[model samples]
Each structure stands twice: as C-alpha cells, then as structure tokens.
Target chain A: MRETLRYVASRLATTFLIVLGAMILLFALSALVPGDPATALLGPAATPEYVQRFIQEMGLDQPWYRRLFSFMGNVFVGNLGTDVLSGQPVTRIIANVLPYTFILTFSSIGLAVAFGVPLGCYAATHRGSLLDHLLAFVSVAFIAIPSFVIAIFLLLIFAIWLDWLPVMGAGEAGNWFDQAQRLILPTIALSVGWIGFIARLVRSSMLETMGENFIRLSRAYGLSNRLITYKYALKNACIPTLAVLGMGVGRLLGGAVLVEIVFSRPGLGRLMFDAISTRNFPVLQGTVLVVVLIFVLTNLLVDLSYAAIDPRIRRQGSR
Target chain B: MNPDLPMITIRNLKLDARTEHGPAHILRGIDLEFGRGRIVGVVGESGSGKSTLVSCLLRLLPSNIERLEGEILFDGIDLLKLSPSDMNDWRGRKIAMVFQDPMTALNPLFTINTHLRDVLKRRFPQISAREARERSLAMLTKVGISDASVRLDAYPHQLSGGMRQRIVIAMALLVEPDLLLADEPTTALDATVEAQIVDLFDQLRQDFSGSIVFISHHLGLVAELCDDLCVMYGGTIVETGPVAEVLARPRHPYTRALLDCEIEDDHGGRLATIPGEVPSATWAMDACIFASRCAHVADICRRGPTVLETVAIGHKAACKRSREVLP
Candidate 1:
C-alpha cells in the first residue's frame, strides 16, 4: 500500500510539470498571434491616453517576460485572472462546461468497450468464419475513413434523413432520457474510429490468451465452452486490452473536439472553439490549460495501470 | 461370457483434420479394447498421433477437424452419441486428462481452489464454497503437496513445476475418473521430479482403482510404467502387447527401432536414431508406414496397409512381415 501511494504521488508530480509546459505553450501562442491585446481591447477611435491607461491597467505595458511570470504566479495562487470580455474569473467558465466533457468522454468509451471486446473475442475464436471476416473488413474500413467523415455521415443519416436523434445542442428539452437520446448519434460518431482501433488490439490479445496452455487445460478439465472463454480466456486477455483502453482515454478526449464541433454541444470542445472564433484570450487560455491538465492526469493514470495489469511492474522496483 | 465389457472400447476410430494447406488424416482406423484397472502406455515418436488419439478420446480436438468416424464406447455406452452437455459430465467423472508442461498446464490467473471447485461444483452443486475449498485442500495433500492447505489461495504461477503437476494430479483424482489420460506428464519436470511422477503412478494405481493411459516417446519409461503397451506410427497403432512380451521381443520393425533409439541407458556409446523421417500425412502412401526405415523390408512391404493379427493372448501387431522382422 505504501509503495502504491508513492508511485501515484511521484506520477502526479510528473503530470503537474507536463500540464505546466502545455499552459506555457498556450500562453506563448496567445501572445505571439497577430494584433496586440491592448489595441484589440481599446477601439481604434479611442484616445491614445485612454488606450495607454487601459493597457497599463491590463499589465500589457509591462515587459513580456514579467507579464508571463505574473500570469503564471496568479494561476499558482488559484486566481485564474478575470475574463477580458466578461470580467468574471476564467475558472467559472471551466466549472460550468466540465461535466459535459466528462459525459461525452465516458459514454463514448463505454460504448467502444461494450462492442470491441466481444467482437474481437468472437473473431479470434472463429478465425476464418464469415463473422470474423466481416468484423475485420468493417473495422478496418471505418478506421481508414477518418473520424470527421464518419461524424458527417452519421449526422446525414441519423440526424437529418431518418431523424432518429437530435442533430444539435444537447437538446433544449432534456431530462435524463432526452439527454441520452441526444448523445446517441454524436457519441457513436466519436466512438466509431476508436472502436475500430480497439478491436484490432482486442482480437490479437484474445488470440494470444486462447493459445495459453491453461485454456487448453481448462477444456481438458471438463469445463464447458462458456467457462473457458469468459473466466479463463477473458481474464487473461484483459491486461493487454486494458492498456489500450487507458491510452484511448486521452485520444478520445482529444478527438471530442471534432465531434463537439459537428454536434454543437455545450462541452469544453465547443467552448474552446467559440473562444478561438471570438479571439477571447482568457477563455481560450483557460480551456487549453484545463484540457492539458486533464490530459496529463489521465496519462498518469494510464501509466499507473501498467502495475495493476502486470504484477511484474510492481516487482520491478522492489528487488 | 457375461459380455459386461471392458472400461473403454475404441472401435475403428478415425479422425481427420483440415488445415490451411489441406486435409490431414490424424487417426486412421484405431481398434482397441482397454479393460478396467489396467495401465496402458501409448509409445510413439513426435507426430505419431499419440496426442491426437488421446485428444479424440476426450473430444478435445481443434475446431477445424473435419471428420471423425467410429464410436468410443466407455462402459458399453457410445461417447460420441452423447449430447455436448452430457459429454461435459462424462469428461471429469468418467475420463480426465493431465497434459505435459506442468509449469503452464494450469490457469495462471486462478488459485488452485478455483480450478478444483469449478470441476467439483458441476457434479456436487449443493456443496458450499467453503466446503469445496476444504475438500480441495485435503485432495491437494493427497497428491503429496506439503502445504496443500496453505496453497489453496495461490495461483499456478506462484507454484513450482512439480507442485503444479501434483495439483493437477490431485484435480484429476478428485473427480475419481475411471480413466486418466496423462500425455507426457513428466516431460517438463526435472529428472528427480520425473522419477517421483513415474513412481507416483504405481502407488496411485493401487489406491485409486482407475486405469491410466500414459503417452510418451520414451520406450524405457513405457516399459517401467505400463502393464500394456501400444506402439503408434503414421497415425495408426503399429504394435501392442503386455509390456514385458512386447519389449522383450519387438515384432514390428518400427517398434524394435523405437526401442533401439532409447539413449539414456546407452552408457557412453553414441545414441541410435530411427532411420528416415516419419512420412507426411499429405503424401500418398501405398506401403507399410515404417518401410522406409526397415532394414529387412521385402518387396511385398510396399504394397498396402498391414492388417493387425493376434500374436499372443492379448497382443497384436500390424505388419505383413512380422515373422521376418522379429528378432
């Protein structure tokens, strides 16, 4: 238990450094882009004295290095700084939209796992059967086509033509059931490419597990087909499949940007897109930092999962 | 005669498998009657269909196997005719198999109790998990696992090779199967452990009252462990008899050559190898399976399959030239 905690703590420290680096990058890009924040904030028709005073108040008058340090210092002190447009704290904007991003990422991942594992196991067991060939063909086909194309196609069929689900806005009239209905099309669209990618991993892992001597022994022990496949084969296959799942969390979170734009949901992806379009520096910077932080934390969790999947990882440092 | 029957009656069994290349004949007509309470050691070279034959008895062949004909009669009941669910019940209770490589022959993720209870729970459905654990621990001690009680929670990966095999042996015996198929059980153990496993068979036979089907490429071990011996070649039984009679005077050329190839007790002299490779199943054969390796092969040996003929009261050999080939 002591060792597990130490491992997690050190990993958390490493993740903090990574988030810090991403924030620095976002701030650097925000500053370097064409048009000064001072000119953009104070209209061109305003007096130079008024414009200069507003710039001084905004700390744009300070040297670039001093301004960057001050921003970082304020972030460290838990002050996200005020939004240039709204005069509200940037953290408030993130707090409101965070739940939607979580829902999108979690639901899409749940869908991917529910389909990928069984399909892969079936393909491995059947090998050259029709079901195996069809799964391989379709998964590879979807993987190669790109997520954006899949999103557009899903929208066309399910949202526009058939009208099975809502095309946009998390649905204005949404209780739990309505929200779930709204999520169906976009979550599937976001998950199609991921499911395809995960299926291949699941297939190979299942094949390897089935070949293990114990699975044969299980059959020899008078175990029914169901017992051997699920209890023996699936448990052995979980370690490798879980590794892929951990990394997929980050990729799915990143990929949600495209899906959010397509569906126009009020998730972080949409908020980030809107901030970019309106040139709202505080909102844009805040969203980037939040995404970066979540990405780093998720990756740390992924790294920690290696130990659970394999007892050897825990033994690695002990001896 | 009461016609009450021997324990297992394998009559004209034939199994064929299809691979990516083509259809491969695994078992050609195998006719044998193994009576109750007799240990039969099946001796052969690699790819001689020993494993394939044993796997067929359990109906554990790979899914790609194309055709299986003939009936396996376990106590006068045709095993192949039973539905799959019935077959599941027949397997652990009537027949159980312990494979080679004790190191990996048990599930690594499961505790020994998990594997034992899984089999026990099927027949003894009313037994509680706690009682199942106790029964397994007691059985583990029966197979000479020293801390059998403590090892119940340990996985296969945590145990030594010898311990794992012991656990597997215990599992097979726990169900009190009438026939136990052991396919090279000692091949993966150390020499000391091998000796122990070999010796364990003799001690086990007296107490358990079960017939053991031991499969190996070792002729010497076959002579030591088995009361009856069956020699396999080209996916067919070549020779079979009481071990002393068969080993003392090997009639079939293939059987003699296999005994001559035993190297462990050969002292410092160079070991012998059987001449020529075993023929591939895909190749068309119109002769004795071992004709290529026989030194005294006559012209008629190349004609066709040799029929089995009784040489002694419970002995048989499949060679047209058995008289000429015998030493």
Candidate 2:
C-alpha cells in the first residue's frame, strides 16, 4: 500500500509539471497570434478611442510578461476571466460545455474498446483466414480515412440522405433518449477510426503474446482456446494497448473538435473554434489547459494501471 | 488399465515441418515404449527432434507441421485419433509436461496461487476453491518448497528460477498424471540448482508411480536418473537399451561418439567433440541418416535405409554394423 502511494505521488508530481508546461506553452502560443483582441472584438467600425478603452479595461495594454503572470495568477485562483463576445466568465462557459465533451470522448472510446479488442483477438487467432484478411483490410481502410472525413460522410448518409437522425446539434438536455439518439452519428463518426486503430494494435499485441512461452504452456496444460486467448494472452497483450489508449484519449479529444464543429454541437471544441475566430484568448487558453490536464491525468492512470496488471512492474515500483 | 501393460507405446511415428525450402522431416519413424513406473531418458543435441517428440506426445506441434502420421497409444487408446476437446481432457489430467525454461513457463501476470489453483480446477471441475488451495499447498510442500502457503500468494516474478521450476513440477504432479514429459527441465539453471532439481526428481520417484520421459542433452544426467536410455541422432533413435547396458556397451558409433563428448575432470587433453554437423532436417533420407558423420560409414550405410537391429536382450541399434562397433 505504501509503495502504491509513493508511485502515485511521483506520478502526480510529473503530471503537475506537464500541466504547468502546457499552460505556459498555451499562453505563449496564444500571445503570438497576429491579431489584437480589442480590434477583433470591437470591429473596424468602432472608434479608436473605444478600442483603446476596451484594451485598457481588459488589461491588454499591459506588457506580455505581465499579462502572462496575471493570467497564471487568475488561473491559480479559479478565475478564467470573461469572454469578450459573450460577456460571461470563461470558467462558466467551459463548465457548461464540459459535460457534452466528456460524454462524446468517453462514450466513443468505450465503443472503440468494446468492438476493437474482440475483433483483434479473433483476427489474431484465425490468422491467414479470409475473415482475418477482410478485417485487416477494413481496419486499414478505416484508419487511413481521417475522422472528419468519416464524420462528413456519416452526416451525409445518415442525416441528409436517409433522414434518420438529426442534421446538427447535441439533443435537448434532460431528455436522455433524444440525447443518446443524437449522439449516435457523431460518436460513430469519431470512434470508427479509433476502433480500427485499437483493433490493429490489439491484433499485433495478442499475436506476440500468444507466441510467448507461458501462453504455449497454457495450451500445453489443456486450457480451452478461449480461456488461453482471452484471459491468458489478452491480459498481457493489453498492457501496450492501455498505454496507447491513454494517448488515444488526447487524439479523440482533438478529433472531437472537428466532429463538434461538423455536427454543430455545444462542446469545448466548438467553444474554442468561436474563441479562435473572435481572438478570445482567455477562453481558448482555459479550454486548452483543461484538455491538457485531462490528457495528462488519463496517462497517469494508465501508468498506475500497469502496476495493477503486471506484478513485475509493481515490484519495480516498490523498489 | 491393466497394471502389467506398458503405460505408453509409440509406433512408426513420422512428422514433417513445412520450411521455405519445402517439408523438413522432423521425426522419422520413431518406435518406443514406456513400461509402467519406468523413467526413460531421451538424449540428443539440438535439432535431433527430442523436443519435437515430446510436443508430438501432447499433440502440440507448431502450425508449420505439414504432416504427422503415427500411433501414440497411451494404454491402448490412440491419442492422435481423439478430437481436440477430448485431447484437452487427456492433456492435464492424464499426461502433464514440465518445460525447459521455468523462467518462461509460468505466466508473469498471475500469482503462483492462481497458476496452481487454475490447473487443479481445470483438471477436476467440481473441485472447490478451498480444496484446490489445500491440494496446491500440499503439492508445493511435497516439491520441497518451504512456507508453501506464503509462496502461493507470490507472483511468479517474485520467485527464483529454481523455485518457479519447483512450482511447475508441483503443478504437473498435483494433477496425478499417468505420464509426465519433462523437456530439459534443468537446462536453464545453474550447476548447483540443476543438481538440486535432479535430486528432487529422484525424490519424486518414491511417490510418483507414473512413467516419465526426460529429454536432455546432458549424458551424465540421463545415466544418473533414467532406467532406460534412447540415443537420438538426425531426427531418429540411433540406439536404445537399459541405461546400464547402453552406457556400458554402446552398440552404435554415434552413441559411442556421444559418450566420448562427455567432459570428465581427469581428462588432461582437449575436450572431445563429434566431427561434422547434424544432418539438415530438410533432407529426404533413403539411407542411414548418420552415414555422412559416422566414423564407421561404409557403402552399405549409404545404400539403404537403416532399421533397428537387435544387439542383445532388450538392446537395439539402427546401425547394421552394431556388433563390430560395440566397444
């Protein structure tokens, strides 16, 4: 138990450093955008005096380092400033849409794992068969196609052509059935490529694990093929898959940006898109920071899970 | 299950492995028998099909096997004729195996407890978890593992190589298999550990009445532990006899060469090595497989296939010149 505690503590320290670095980098990159926030918000028709007053009011008139320090200071105190266009605190805007993004990301990943792991395992065990080849071909095709392209195609076929689902937007809040119905197309669009990616990963890893001496021993012991493949082989094979899945979370989040825009859904991706166009640096910085934190935390969880799955790693951590 | 009958009999067994060049004949017309309660040692260098023979016993041949024709009659029933599911039932319950590298034998992701308990549960489906644990703990203690209860909870990675090997032996023995196939069980261990494991096998002989087929490259180990010995060369048994008789008077040139290769502390000269490489497994032999490397190679050896000829009571050699070659 103490070893676990030390392991988690060390991982948390690393996560903190990663999030801080991402925050600093996000601030610097946003500052480098070639547009003045005041000008973008006020428009060309606005008088120079109004623009000057707006700049001073929002503290854009301060030097870059001071702005960065104040931004960091405000973030540390749980304040993300106001959106210039909406006139709402950036934190409130983020909090409102965070649930939608979380639903999309988690549900899509859950779907990917549900289908990918089994398909990959089947393909590996039946290697060189026609079905295995077909799965291989289909997975490669899906992986080669970008998620946005898939989203557009799915949107066209399901919403526009078939008229089977909503054309846009996350469904009405508090209505579980309608919300799930709307989530179908976007989730499918987002998860298809990931399913292919994960399947390919699991296929290769399972193949390698099956070739291990212990797996052969399991077979020699007369364990059923299903038990050996799913339980014995998959447990060891899933280690690499877990690490990849952690990184997949970040990729899926980035993919959600385009999917949300294409679907016109209310999410951090859509918020960031609007903020980028309006030069709303505070909202953009806040959203990016949250995404970075989620990515780092998921990866930390993945690392800790390695200890849970493999005793060799657990012993190493204790040492 | 007549107690007077031999435990297992293998007849005219042949196996071919698919290689890039074509099919490689891995095992060529093997004939052997194991009397009840006897320990047989099969010794050969790498590529001599010693390991393949054991895999054949379990029907665990690799995917590249092109053909396998044989009768593996375990107590009058042919193992090769059984369906896969039936074979599975026969595998752990009737015949268990111990592999060469214990370091790689047990799954690293599982605790020794899980490894032991799972095997018992699989063999005896109605066995309670508590009973399985107790049986496993008893087997561990029987295998000379101290603090067996505590060791059960430890993962395989936490144990030393010798300890893991003992656990593997414990697992095999716990099933009370009628036949135990051990493929170089101590080849991966240090000299001291190897001796200890050998002694453990000696101790197991007292309780384990089942037949054992021990495969190894170490001639000394086989001479010390086995009641019968089979000398293999070029994927075929070159000689077989009572261990004492074979070691005392090897009837085949290859067997003589092998015994010479064993290192002795009093030897002052260079280490003895058999001349020539093992014949390529891909070759289709119509003559003596060892003709190219045998010191006593003659025109007759290259002219026709060699078959085992009786040298004495319970002794045989594949070489036609067995009587002249005997030292």
Error of 1 at A148 (Å): 5.1
Summarize candidate 2's per-residue lDDT along B31-122 as a digit string, tens digits. 99878889999999998999999999999888898999989999999999999888888888888999999999999999888888778888
DockQ metric, candidate 1: 0.52
Q: Give the residue spans of candidate 2 off by over 4 A.
A: A31-52, A60-66, B265-269
* Model 1 interface root-mean-square deviation: 2.0
Which portions of model 1 miss their true places by more than 4 Å?
A1-77, A80-87, A115-167, A171-181, A192-204, A274-285, A299-319, B1-4, B19-22, B263-268, B325-327
Q: What is the TM-score (0 to 1) of candidate 1?
A: 0.86
True contacts kept of each: 0.63, 0.71
Lowest summed lDDT over 10 consecutive residues: which window, candidate 1 chain A? Answer: A310-319
Lowest-sum lDDT 10-residue window in model 1 chain B: B263-272
The TM-scores of all predictions, comma-separated, are 0.86, 0.96
